[model samples]
Target chain A: MLNYIAVSTIPIMIFIIIIVGVKEKKDVYNLFIEGAIDGLKIVYKIFPYVLGITVAIGLLRNTNALNIILTPVIPLLNKLGVPMDIIPLMALRPLSGAASTSLVMDIFKNSGPDSISGKMASVIMGGTETTLYTITILFAAAKTKSLRGTLIAGLLADSVAIITAIILINIGII
Target chain B: MSKIWSCIILISIIIAFLTGNPNAVTSSVMSESKIAVENIITLTGMMCFWSGLFKIFENTSLLEKLSNKINKLVLRFFDKNELTKEAEKNMSLNITSNILGIGNAATVNGIKAIEAMAKVNKSDKPSNNMTKFVLINTASLQLIPTSMIALRTLYGSSNPTNILIPVWIVTIVALVVGLVSISILNKIIK
Candidate 1:
């Protein structure tokens, strides 16, 4: 069951890791500290990206700016049987995982978890990438020269996810 | 990057001013930054725990073992001899973690893989293989949708895993479409 796997995955991993560490005669605790510190540094590095996106999205949402920005596409999307409410989630999903994540929470809170729209939104979030964030941080870490193509392609894939999620919902598959 | 960042702030300010709710921007910025900080703070513990466990996995060469096991399969996605050995290693590990549904490790491997590729490629722009790598990560194929199911359960879905079949279907379709699109674009552009 999903619940069991989700609940126990970490503990199982930890158990296996401890055994492997002992078998290798390794100081697992210290190794973990080192990795933890690295994680700390990573969080520090990526925080700005996360914060900028959140602030931008929060402002748009609080000021009702997103509605105005998205209003033009609403009619067409509606005609396509796309759920009116999830369009923003689709647009933002590839942009910022944290922001779209909070949006998913909002949908679940308001729509109830069992609603088709809620389930569909959850599926989209799960299936797609936080494309911009991943590309930016990874390319920066890699020191790659090409940034534009990655972002564009990532966004294109995200659009595929968006359309696929909508169609599945329309077809009553989810 | 600077252009997009500045444009976002500028647009937010203009929207606030035109909407006659300038205070909303300030309040929202403050609250959202707080949320972001909180998000990081809470995730830090879990991140640390997993990172530590992964290190043990890495130190004992378990990662390398798994990486080697999948190396042949991973190579099929990439060109033979196009990537350096280091790049291939990272890519194999990345693909393995992705298939296992462990997103965190997948990302770490992805970045490392790109780093390896960058070292080998002398060009300034993204190399062909790097573009494929990005698309693959974007449409990652994993066995479990753990996070989504967890969220669904947290929100009271009786059958949180109901999307299991649909998620796989959509992800695979997205992956195939993305690969085809990128390959076409690559040919047209190059």
Candidate 2:
């Protein structure tokens, strides 16, 4: 079923593109080439930025940096009765969406999807944005040289989501 | 990004060496190298495909038609018709992409949208509108979290859609809080 949907989407997209191209009398092939070139350029531009972040994430994970760092903060959150399992996910969510997602998938693998922690992971993942990624990529692209109040505001919102998710679960809403 | 990334990797590597586990860094790079290349390839292709489509969308003026409705809401929210044309268009497109859960595509426009906003403001420092743009952009209200739903289904959830309500509620609250606070901060700071 998933395959069917995936396959259908591409053809449907192609069909629409072709129709639109014809309607607009656009040079579809050339426009496509131009877009591909632009895309490659953007990917090239961001590749180093992405590599840097990915390596940092990988090394941090393997070296247990997050674990070590979170140890001190864990007690505080623990005192609030936030589930221990999803703590790493919360810590990583603002860093990279993909990284935290891989962590959430790991949670699902270790525990069933219906588990309390699993639901919480899903909620937090969906509710919050990748704050660091958002700030880094957008601000960098815009050449906003300074870290401004935006970061604080976004992180504050994420914390609200985190607290809300925990509250909802503890109250048995999920 | 450069500063943040360098600080993180540098600190991580230094700590690894100091802890006598430098090999961990090597292994991480080796493993991540393959995955990162594959991801970058996929991301590049995905971006190309969408950009091509959006190019066509533009040529056909379909984008204009589609964004027309969304721009109404944006105009009302921003409470002005004084937005530069490019800014208004980018804002509508960004919102449309986010609602459709095309996040990577949304980022391209999000950057463009904010830049456009800043351009209109004609100020070096972020104006209230620009700051508000980043706040809501990061809050990222989504109608369909495609990745979340897929992950849930893969995990054998009987009803994967169950996460939708919680996600919506949380996101809405975040959006509200972010908007209100950013506006308040804007007044206080500037």
Candidate 3:
């Protein structure tokens, strides 16, 4: 898998290097280095937000808050044909991918990878997004404030992801 | 708000534990460390690859050309008379990051886009534009969901790529909904 991605990306990388170096009259190596640095800078800036959110989520799960949230929703989701076990994942879907991933890992560990619950949760996590967090941090970085219709729109989009994930899993698309 | 939810969840867990079914709460906490480490590795790798790709694209001037081409459509979304250097940079960054499926990376760029838009939208509460941009950033379409695929691999899934179709579908739908809402809301506000 690593080899496939690496090999495929090579042509792309070389193409970029040639175009930037010759056509654009830019230093491809320096741009590569700078980009990497910028990437690290981004990670550094967001690290605090990531840490706080992760720890808060951790504490919440530790105290059974997620279960409480999931308990009522599970029946409704299941009635809609969404897997009962995937409810927690669905709830976490709009938070952070890494955070939901940690949650999904736990689900996979307990339920095992082959279980329907695990499969469905994986699909949902992979399919949906953390709309609020994305909006918050992005806006904060640029120093903008009002949400307008964004919250509604983002949540609605997440619902689409959740519903699509359930439908796909049920139909055995994978 | 989180604290209130925490208290409620804690009470419920206690109730469930007393009732003799504790697996739900127990399992959720048990899987943290492994998940955390795995995600870090996957995200780091994915971000590295994407950023690398972005730099290469930028170096080639492809991103700039693309930015200019999309400027009209982009301007329509947020009517700013004069596009600044920072705004152009932010837009290119947003586009590149979104394409690579790293919305996290795009947030900063999105903010810059909003900042540039703010200069032009002087009368409006900056928060309004900020929020709208957040929606767009959150709904940003991802062509290659590297972090998600990595998570699947970490969890030992047989077919990580199976998620591609659904992700593509949801991403596009979300983008459409987000854009429509912003446009409608802008009209209402105006």
Candidate 2 lDDT over A35-77, as tens digits, reads 7677678777766645655566667777766566677788887
The TM-scores that each candidate's chain B achieves against the reference are 0.69, 0.67, 0.67
Worst lDDT run of 10 residues, candidate 1 chain A, spans A2-11
Please name the candidate that would achieve the greatest lDDT relative to the true structure: 1
Clashing pairs in 1: none
lDDT of each: 0.74, 0.72, 0.61
Best by DockQ: 1
| Candidate 2 lDDT score at position B177 | 82
True contacts kept of each: 0.59, 0.51, 0.41
Docking class of 1: acceptable
How well is each residue in A33-103 modelled by candidate 1, as lDDT tens digits?
A: 98888767766776776677667766777777767677898788678887655865876787766567666
Q: Which stretches of candidate 1 lie over 4 Å from their true place?
A: A1-52, A81-85, A95-118, A132-152, A169-174, B1-45, B81-84, B101-127, B145-163
User: How high a TM-score does candidate 2 get?
Assistant: 0.68
List the candidates' TM-scores in order: 0.74, 0.68, 0.70
Instruction: Give one digit per residue, the lDDT tens place, for model 2 in B1-190.
Output: 4565576678778878878998998998887665556555546665666566555554566655667878888767684644788887888888777765556557878888877776665556676667777777788577655557656766787666677778888898888888877777777665
Higher TM-score: candidate 2 or 3?
A: 3
